[model samples]
Target chain A: MMKELRTAIRAIIVFTIMLGLIYPLAVTVFAQIFFKSQANGSLIVNQDGKIAGSVLIGQSFSSPEYFHPRSSFAGTGYDAIQSSGSCLGPTNKKLVEAVAENLSKVLKENPGVKAKDVPVDAVTASASGLDPHISPEYAELQIPRVAKARSMDVSEVRALVDKYTDGRQIGFLGEPRVNVLLLNLELDRIKKVSNRR
Target chain B: MAGSMWFLLFIYLFTLLVLSIPLGLFMAKVFNREKTFLDFLLVPVENFCYRIFKIDARAEMRWTQYAFALLVFNLVGLVLLYLLQRIQQFLPFNPRHFGAVAPDLAFNTAVSFVTNTNWQAYSGESTMSYLVQMAGLAVQNFLSAATGIAVAIALVRGIVRKETKTIGNFWFDLTRSVLWILLPLSLLIAPLYIWQGVPQNIHAYTDVNTLEGAKQVIAQGPVASQEVIKELGTNGGGFFNANSSHPFENPTPLTNFIQILTIFLISAALCITFGKMSGDKRHGIVLLVSMILLFVTGFFFAYKFEKAGNPQFAALMQRGTVENMEGKEVRFGVLNSSLFAVVTTCTSCGAVNSMHDSFTPLGGLVPLFNIELGEVIFGGVGSGLYGILLYAILSVFIAGLMVGRTPEYLGKKIQSFEVKMVMLGVLISPACMLVLAAIGVVTAGGMAGISNPGPHGLTQVLYAFSSGAGNNGSAFAGLSANTLFYNILMGVDMLIGRFAMLIPVLAVAGSLAEKKKVPMSIGTFPTTGFLFVVLLIGVLLIVGALTFFPAISLGPILDHLQMLKGILY
Candidate 1:
């Protein structure tokens, strides 16, 4: 037992150093060297050279001038103090009422679009409450509203949405969606660049 | 949910099944100690490890010795991890400067990781430091998983070797499993996780302003490296409280699919490894099929219930379309969340892509029931294969009784010692889970953790106990289990749940190793056909249902009935 205990101790220390210290260090170094921007929270920079947000985290876009991300419950909408979901049971009255409230608000924003036409994700709270992307359908639904709000040609804004649309990975892994933060950022860049021209 | 969503579920499972076959073949080669493509990398590293640890690569041990070594090795890890957590305040890379964890929570975490049940009582981003996350948590992710696979290999050796007193060396199995299987696989998967948007850095948390004018501090750390193994190792504790639901941990749908697939990858392949070890691939196929049957059943139920949405909402608002987006990522929807919940629970990889606590009553039932079913539906990493084999033994023993002939499996005559051990292995977790859950409901400390009162609260306690004793780490999240009572009790629950079953399993290995291989005859029961799959599933369900029916009735089932009548709780 004593000898076995010694063996066990030695083996654990060796394995821990190999796995715990070495493995994570190796991966960290790889990420640091190769994927620096993404490794550090994928932080997105604004036109002013200031840290705006991440390419991953969703931000609220209440002014129709920008495309809206999904509704959030992360401490008053995308508060990252505690990343979480609403965790309301499907039948919970709170969830039902919240969705209804969101539905009306979205329809009011997109004038011609009715409640039924509103995308489910547009009205629903996401799991992390920090989802950065919205469905292509949802993005398209808001295109006219966003274009009108920005006083841009619908075709140009539509083209911007198409440009940022990430299709399914490997032809069929996840749903095709557009990154709202990135898309809106691109929209801003497009308008700015065009103005300079 | 649309038809396409249901179709997506099948497509994902089909893809996983197809990938598992080739992966399983590779695993078989690795386990048989045959030459592998990874030998170049493994040989030198493994040889060095064996020499450094003074573990003779060829030396084998009796089943008792093997179990002893496994327990002691794991004990060393538990102590080390606990020490790391206690002293983490003084460690480097703590950008958060998080202090030492409380004693009870720290104790719970140590046992949780060592037992291959990575149940987090506290939120990771809030509680643990980067040093602890990598050194303490990530290290156990590898060791605990290797420990599970080692025991499984030992059991395989015990069955394969006729008239042998010794199984393979614990040290050898542990070393090779990591050197060849785990490390190589993680190398491939971790990089891909980063490519798909999971952050992997030693950087501090980034403070960003949301458009709502609220300050949001995005937590950042060595996420991808820990993540690959968190799923790959079937250790479900997350770096963040939202678990896989968090965008940083599971950035996109592709990453989400990959994460769920990785959880089942090694576990599914282990079945094939078992078959190859026993010299008949059919035995493994049967077990895998039974597991698949249970998984699909659970998946269907969870999906259907979640998709049905809240009927009360339909009535109240007279809405046309109803899809349950509550507690689910709109990105994945009901189908993926349901599939993920079932897979995670069934395999004892308790990583939640969606909150199980928020599922419709019947939808939530499937995962809780999956854990109660002893997690043999593909089980956890190495533990899953061995766990189902325990059920297979029980099934064969029953078949022998039915036919009025002595029971035999893989040409080994069933004996009293083996049966008793199987019984011991089978009953321990359910007994521990139920008794503790019953006690938890009656106690103030335990009840204090229940966020929802009434039946839903009962389930919070029940799921915690089940998750603990079953060595599955997914919690209901409604249960605030960081209190002293829960920490102490569930910590105790994890230990007994893991070892009690493990000791019996090792004993069975010893007993079987001593028996001579009996010849197959006309009256022998065929274990690989359709009937065997049915019987295996039946035995698993019956045992689990019988043991947990009352507790489940008081929890999810009753909660479901209340939901039907628009009762919120």
Candidate 2:
């Protein structure tokens, strides 16, 4: 029995070191060398060289000049650390009221936008509160308002929207969405370039 | 929600079924101790490859030793994944030039995949780099699954052997599981997935023109390899946030079908393997039948409720096209969405071609109920079988008490020590869940996570607990769960919910290993019969329903009633 116990103990120690310590170290080293960008979080930045946010996490943008992501339950909005959605069911009165309130707010902010023109994503919160992108329709809805606000042609804003829209994997997986932070950053850049012109 | 989405979902399902069966069968043969067709055909090739790599395959271990090896392997994976997320900014392959994942999130993800749960607090496309996705997440997908298979094999060994001290070799099992099972199956399935439109390229994101003449940036990766294990292993974390709902992850209705089948294939096949290992194919079939019946029943409810859609939406829309699909993928339709929801939750596989949260109160309840049932309807790979076996032992114990005789499962006696271990394995998660939910509901901090007030809000909390405790990993996503409090709390739940049960299970394995295997007598109750199968299923249902009934009544059942009456309260 003692011999069996000793054998088991030895086995555990040797295997633990090899699997728990050595293997992981090797994989980490491999990841570091082969896939650097992805080994790191896919963060994006602004022209001012400030670390804005990751291209993955949705950020709050209430201004008309920027495209708004899906409604967020994060503290304030789009808090990455506090990622979550409002756990409201479709039939809940609170959700209905909240959606109504949000719609009113969107209408109030973006004057002359038709009620029908408002995108569903603009009103509803995503499953992940940290969803970084909005529906293409939501992006499109903001085009006129953003173009007018930034004093750029609607075509240019539309072009930028087109630029950021990610297609489905292998041309058929997910719905097309525009990363808001990326679009906004590019918007900022285009504005600066036009200013120079 | 949309007919097109339903069409696409059907295609995806078809594809998954087509691919998973052969793959699952192949995996079973590889893991079997007895030589298989592959042993004869692939021995030379395997030897050649091993020789080329200077590999040694002589390592052996007892069942307990094997379990420890798996645990230790994952612990290392957790540390490495955590560290990689912390230091990725300094690493390579980052064309977008990303940085490390936040500490808490990294810890959560590492634990999630290592436990075979694949719950994501962070989105895949944005948070993970290509390297992290492949090495950290994808690698874990394979190893974690192999770990589950290894554990199941250990448990089986305990049942089959008579007074055996050792179960099997840890190193040998792990290697064989990966090399013979996961690899060849993946090799075949990956290409099939590619042919069916799942991506298999190393090229970066590309630019494409849309129907509306908009230029879209398409996210592409080496997806086929990930998809193979992702489904086969039942690790449901998608390459994209939409998960299987994303068209890329599940392109055609055939693929959707295949993906769904892939989720349950190994789990189902493992039952057959169990019977074969026990020298009773009937035993495996009986268990499989029980699981299938439970699964089909859950699917029925989900289908009915979803097809009914929301009565409120019917009243509002006049036409009532809502079909209870507020958060569903339009391509899958109500039927497939409902089916997928039940299957994924029942199996502890979170792959969803449709959003689970969008199902009607009753529709959503089916999946939620499956989780709360302890996911024994073929739960996570190794975890699922052992979980069911634990229940099987419990059922026999209860039966023994009723009949005034010592209980036996298969040929082994269920002693007091084994009973306690099984009970601990069963009760720990629910205890953690109820306590946390109670704290969350009462506290201001907890209430802050509630986005919707009233019964459905309560349901969301219950769902979170159910998902966490069961290790399902999918979420209502409606709850504010990414907070420091939730992160820390759920992370604790994930760990304890996982290892707490695992330790007890390993203890049971050890105890069973030492027990003498008894021969079947006329007085002995045959576990491999329809009667026993019904009894086992009944016990599972009774335990789940009795334990969670009040909670369910407070959440989905009550919310459903209130919705019918249009009552806010």
Candidate 3:
């Protein structure tokens, strides 16, 4: 029994160092050497050389001039450090009410859009409240409002939305969606150019 | 379902079957002590480990010694992990400088990870530091999995070695499993995960200004390294609270597919290993087919219900036109999310690409049902193979009773003692789960953790205990399980669920190891035939369904009926 105890102790410590410390460090070193940008949170930069949010993580976009991301259940909304989901059951009244409230809000924000016209992703909360993409249908629903708010031709904003839209990987995986932050950033850049003109 | 969805499902299963074949053969070679492609590089390191630990490489043991060694090693691991969490604030690599975890949460987490449960009462990125994530949790992710593989190999040894008192050396099996198998696989996959946008650094959370200029703090960590093992080991604990749903943990659709595949890779391959070891490849193939059949059936049920979308939203929008999107990532869509949920739950790999709590009731029930089904559908690594084998024994015993002949499995007679041990092993989880869940549902402390009301609340309580008792780390997430009542109660439940079954399994192995192989006879049932597969699956389903039917009827079944009637809970 004593011999077994000693063996257990030595084995645990040795294995811990090898697996817990050395293995992860080795992987990190390899990642840092080969895929430096991705290994460091995939941060996207602004025109002013400021650190904007990651292209992968979604941010709250409430302004009428910008495209909005999905409704978030993270702390308040889009609290990146505290990632989470609204774990409300499908049949829960709270979820139904929350979806209804979001639907009305979406209808109010975009004039021509009706209840049926709104994409489900617009009103529904994402699993990671930090979901970066919104369905292309949701993005298009907001196009008229974004164009009206920015004092630009609807086609121009539509063109920008089209440019930022990401299709299914290999054309048949995942869903067709738009990155809200990137599209909004592009809108801001084009707005600046038009202002100068 | 769309034709495309059917195509995607076919591709996923086809890929899994194709990939697991070579891996299964390789694993057989690995444990058989035959030379493999990586042996030249890994053999020296393996020897060094044995030397440093002072393990006699040639020394083997009976089942009692193997079980004792495993228990002691796990107990030590549990204590070390608990202390690490308690003092993590004082530990290095804590760039976040988060304070020590609360006592109850720490205790729960320690037992959770050490048992390979990985059930998270507290969210990551907020509570755990980088060091604890790597040293405490991730180490267990490897060791606990290796422990599982060791026991499985021990069982396999017992089956194949005719009339032997000894099974195999626990130390040697543990070392070779980690060094030759888990490590090599992780090293290959970790880089792919990092390249796909999972962060692999120990930097502090970066404060970023959004385009709209709101302050946001992005959490960073050594995620890719842990992510590989988390799936590969079927550990399911995540670096972030959102688990695989967080874009950082599972970035692209390709990565999501890979993560699901990784969860089943070892468990599926072990079937092939079992076949090769049993000296009859057909024996293993029969079990694998039964597992796949169960898996495909569950996936179809889950996908159909999820694609139908939620009923309450029928008036708010077009129902058929829009699938259930609540608590699901847009990138994964409905199909991938449903597929992920089914795969994760069935394999006892609880990492979720979507929130299961918000799944349409019947869709949610599929995962809950899968876990309740003993997770034998290509279950967690080594645990899965051994679990299905237990059912196979039970099936033969029943067949023997039907006819007037002694039951035999792998050519060993199934006596009363063996049958008793099998019963104890099979009954432990459901008994632990249901009894604990009953107490949880009626008690104030457990009820307090429930996030939804009525049947849904019941589902939450049931899911937590089931996941724990099944050694499956996934959760409904809405359950506020960090409370003192839950942490202690579920902690005990998890230990019972793991060791109670494990000890009995080892005992069965020891008993079997002593018996001489029975020869084929006219009355001997062919275990490699289609009838045996049907019987094996039937026994598994009957045990699972009979035990769990009443409880699920009150939970998801009730919830589904209520939803169709436009009732809200």
How well is each residue in B1-569 modelled by candidate 1, as lDDT tens digits? Answer: 36666567677778877988888888778767888888886799888887788878788799989889888898999999999999999999899989999999999999999998989998888889988999899889998999888888778777888998988888988888898888888988888888777888887888876543456788899999899999999999888888999988998778888988899988898888888878899988999888887888888888888888767545533565466666677567677788889989998789998888788889899999999999998999888988998999999999999888999989999889999999999998899999999999998888898876668888889999999999999988867889999999999999999999888888888889989999999998998799999888888889988988988898888888887777764
Best-matching candidate per TM-score: 3
Docking class of 1: acceptable
Candidate 1 chain A TM-score vs. reference chain A: 0.89
Can you tell me which runs of candidate 1 are displaced by over 4 Å?
A91-93, A100-115, A136-163, A190-197, B1-11, B210-214
What TM-score quantifies how close candidate 3 is to the native fold?
0.98
In model 3, what are the clashing residue pairs, if there are any? none
RMSD of 3: 1.6
Tens digits of per-residue lDDT for model 3 on A1-197? 98888899899999899999999999999999999999999998888888888989999988788899999999999998889999999778999999999999999999978888888999999999999999999999999998988899999998998998888887667888899988988888777534321
Provide the TM-score for each candidate, comma-separated. Answer: 0.94, 0.75, 0.98
Give the alpha carbon lDDT tens digit for every residue of B303-380 in model 2: 878778766555443444335545544334455567778888988777766556555788889989898888889777
Residue B286, candidate 1: Cα error in Å is 1.0
lDDT of each: 0.85, 0.69, 0.90
Q: What is the DockQ of each candidate?
A: 0.46, 0.07, 0.70
Candidate 3 Cα errors over 4 Å, as ranges: A193-197, B318-321
**Candidates sorted by lDDT, best first:** 3, 1, 2
Highest lDDT against the true fold, candidate: 3
Candidate 3 chain B: worst-modelled 10 consecutive residues by lDDT: B314-323
Which parts of model 2 are misplaced by more than 4 Å?
A: A1-88, A94-197, B1-29, B40-60, B202-217, B319-322
Residue pairs with backbone overlap in model 1:
none
